[model samples]
Target chain A: MTTKRSITVTVNGQQHQTEVEPRMLLVHYLREVLDLTGTHIGCNTSQCGACVVMLNGEAIKSCTVLAVQADGGEVLTIEGLAPEGGLHPIQEGFWEKHGLQCGFCTPGMIMASYQLLKNNPHPTETEIRRGLEGNICRCTGYQNIVKAVQDASERMSTSAETPVPAGD
Target chain B: MSVPAAFDYHPATSVDEAIALLQQYGDEAKLLAGGHSLIPAMKLRLSQPEHLIDIGKISSLSYIREEQDHIVIGGLTTYVQIEQSDLLRKHFPLLPEATSMVGDQQVRNRGTIGGSIAHSDPAADLPGVVLALKAEIVVQGPQGKRTIPADDFFVDTFTTALAPDEILIEFRLPKATGSTGSAYDKLANKASHYAIAGCAAVITRGQDGSCSAASIAITGATVRTIRARAVENALVGKQLSETVIAEAVSHATDGEDMIVDIHGSEEYRRKMAAVVARRAIMRALERI
Candidate 1:
């Protein structure tokens, strides 16, 4: 048996120090060790984007990445998208646009979309489709999910020009 | 699913350190790059190495630069980098176009170019593109650094010319010359993430609007990406016309066994290869 290794990872802005088996995946580390279960494991294989998370500001499928691979990386989960009392524009767009039917793929879908918009804030419809292509939503037929990204893009653009009121 | 087996993890900071680890563990050690390919295989018990030499952290092997006669891309450069690189887009548009269509956003973020070539999966999109571009794979071993032409680098399905202790460090794509253009098209399987059939076409148009030189490669229709010599022979010195392009497409899969799987049948994939080859050639011709 191989010995576990001690590593430090920064997740959602908090430093997490732990000793884990060499084989532990980042998805398992987030769910089991840190108790951030928002990242679901739908396919365990990298095929399903259900385990997507932002490692060092880039969206990656956590299941394919070893926890040790993320030792010195900064990670962001769905829980970190919005800090207090409110949803991010993407989350709000999903709620308003009805982007989810089962909610299992929401965290990953949103995380992938988050990275997309972060990199290309104003993507065309075809570009948006390609951007979210990695993320799969078995429900809602992806029509509303595409609409949500459009809605979120508009909201994010509008918010950038005029900041949202602090308390509402 | 749990990983197949427990393995010792060694984080190598430099290429020398990685080589030493590989030499120490021998065939028992496997280099871990982005882990987009190996980890999934390990999870499915397709591969079970006793030691994982983690070379993903070696920062030196991650770069994309333009050289005098070629584009030097570090093997560890991720798909996301290729997709976003303005340097690659300006000189090698085919690379970014193909990289954008790879597994998906998250997969592109973690999958490295080096790992993809090293994996040498027949259905992989980049291998065909690299072969069409006539790229070279640079490897470092205990002996020294050597360059393997892309055609020679890919020997068979899921295999390369890399030895146990040899590490692929970079790929060198010959610079385009004289109204040159390239493109890649693939019919990807939604379930398996492998291309059902893919084609990459690179053409150089002469002053007379005729083909100066053309290189065509097809993947997923065979055990490995192979140069469509028949197509190239038909295309060279011919006018960039629909008739010639059609003839070239017919010869796209001349001497290969098409892969038949859940995604597509042998006949369908063969036909798709012809179609994709024609489209890629036309797209490349238009750019030229």
Candidate 2:
């Protein structure tokens, strides 16, 4: 007996209109309806950073946000980080370095790092570690992840990275 | 498995509409601000409100500025905003300091200060911080607006003085004058980051080099955020030496029930409470 509400969200620079049940979470909407399964739901609760996404220029756990709550808002997910045939600097950093052991937490880690590096272009190792406190990597032990973020910070600052184009 | 029960979603653009929705739905409704706390609880089926009145998008109710002699903060201001606000930083740096300790980067980006205090989780930092600063809580309902002092606002754990039909709209803090300094310290659970022991202290230094007015509050060690009056009484009208401050903070848990949970045992929290309170008070004095 769920009522569906009409909502529109711009995700990864593309706008789509849909109707969702009030109980639907933003993470569920992304994985199920939009077919953007890159945004993992590790804990399903807000404790895990696996569902982190950029909502209105700041990162937030999508699992805790209702689908209808994000109406008329813009969201950036892990898949939208780079265009076709190219890897974003963060993804490149992870690729160049062994940033993942299981890769379950990579997307979320990269998304969270995107916001962190955006706020502070050049962060120290301690700052990078503190930035990833919300994201838990049970297997990898975070040594390489910190290196990956540091690597991305250097690459991003090396040149003025272009903002992801909207709906290209 | 962590799905919330079906409910109606109402996005209120203004304060009046939010209050009106609260009156209309009564007990079956819950106010949604930032949705950081409410939705998490809902996912566990701990709370199943039939209507969710969302006030997170109210632009007019999201601000930080000086009004008259008071620093007025809108109810919808997020933790990240408060942590980055130059106004709050210049005047009340303790707020920003405590705000940074709330959650990780993502949580701080979305959790609102008003929502945190309204939830009044015994472990939350803002309740103790506001109590130390003596923030005036403003609420609105069908009967109109009234201000409640922070001491009377938090009734118990996960409860506040807000009526079913009332919505908290603002928090007003008096402009601190003279040699006033404040600080916050907390021992948080490494994984969850909830406070295991947290203390906030606001102190005013007198011209005589003695402590003038002082307030200290402790959280995560009690059933609710409580003003450590014993600690406050011991510090006032005295030179704040290390021994004097240490003796004062040793009473941080006097006549209080320390919460026993997975994070800590009763005795462990009792011990850590005094440690955090002492550190917070000492840091406040250094600033003064």
Candidate 3:
């Protein structure tokens, strides 16, 4: 018999309670079960970071994490980074700087950059490159992604700390 | 998409609870911490366990603290915690250095030191660093708790000295003091992020600037992480110069089982093993 586990995950400010199979990956749970398709799965083997998400305020490869493992945890996916009315600075930076081409790796890249900028605030070019090592992009060659992160860092540093809006 | 086979899951809240679970399930159960390594293996069908004891939520086992004679790192402490630890960075900097090369930011956030060492992957970074540091691991079984030195902890690839019912609880690393220097250098396989060849060196110099104690451990070139005793023997009581370090590191591939895969041939890996060992030792000398 297949064992099922119950999990309460807060995705993008909304709380979700679901019963998932013990073998289910978190990325599959978000996409197949929860219909949060924004988080892509590039490599199931965990080499690519397309399944990156913020688990309890830290960036982790969702594909590598089992759904049951994330039970009772706060998860902030790519969908939850921005407020209801607007896009987050990272999204704005990607748009303004043309951070991605094809956009498949964009979500993971942005999510990883989100963690990097949050921790380092003003990361150097090398640090930004190092920060996104897990993520792979076949398009844009990552020059624009670096620019987008730098842009977001500049905007975020000059503005208030709460880049993600609350109460909506 | 890859998915693991169905298995009973138990979230263990404490060390005793986890140990009891392990004892109950015995060989059928596997402890899941971080899941960065085990889950991937399960997905590939490389490993199958009827039961999985999730120790990731065991908050008591995730820590890094300074003790009187050594540093105590909890079994579940993630790589990110180690990378950002001031105590580790100030003292045993090789840990952070090697951990930085493990995977990426996200992997580090979830991959625990205990999980890495316990998994004992031939190319894993932590084992090499632990072997270099002469660390000891604390294990708890149905009988009681026992300490195993790093040298004896890793038995073979994908295997450890841990019994089926034993749970690794903590890593005790000797505190680095005085003129101590350590470094880790690796040539990462660009695709898999596993090391093609990696070496870690720890050296403590005497008052007269001579090598008082030295340790060298290398990974990826063999089926298991190995201490390059030949290299250590050459470095002790000698002045660490470029020429001396070069001669000492050349013996890194001596008396070892080398791994041959699509990544590199036996001959190539053997040569690169020495190269990385040289680079690691030189870097350690610079820090000293």
Which candidate tops lDDT? 2
Candidate 2: list runs displaced more than 4 Å. A160-168
lDDT value, residue A107 of candidate 1: 96
TM-scores, one per candidate? 0.95, 0.98, 0.97
Shift in Å, residue B266, candidate 1 = 2.1
Q: Which residue pairs in candidate 3 collide?
A: none
lDDT of 3 by residue, A20-127 (tens): 889889999999999999999998888788989898888889999998888877888888888667788899899999998999999999899989987899999999
Superposed model 1: Cα runs more than 4 Å off: A160-168
Candidate 3 lDDT over B61-167, as tens digits, reads 89899989999999999998999899999889899999889998898999999999999999989899999999999999889999999999888888899988888
Docking quality (DockQ) for each candidate: 0.75, 0.80, 0.87
Query: Per-residue error at A80 for model 2, in Å?
Result: 0.8
Ranking of all candidate structures by their lDDT, best first = 2, 3, 1
* Native A-B contacts reproduced, model 1: 0.88
True-contact fraction per candidate equals: 0.88, 0.84, 0.98
Q: Is the docking of candidate 3 incorrect, acceptable, medium or high quality?
A: high
Judging by TM-score, tell me the better candidate of 1 and 3: 3
Model 1 lDDT per residue over B135-191, tens place: 999999999899999889888888889998999999999899899998988888876
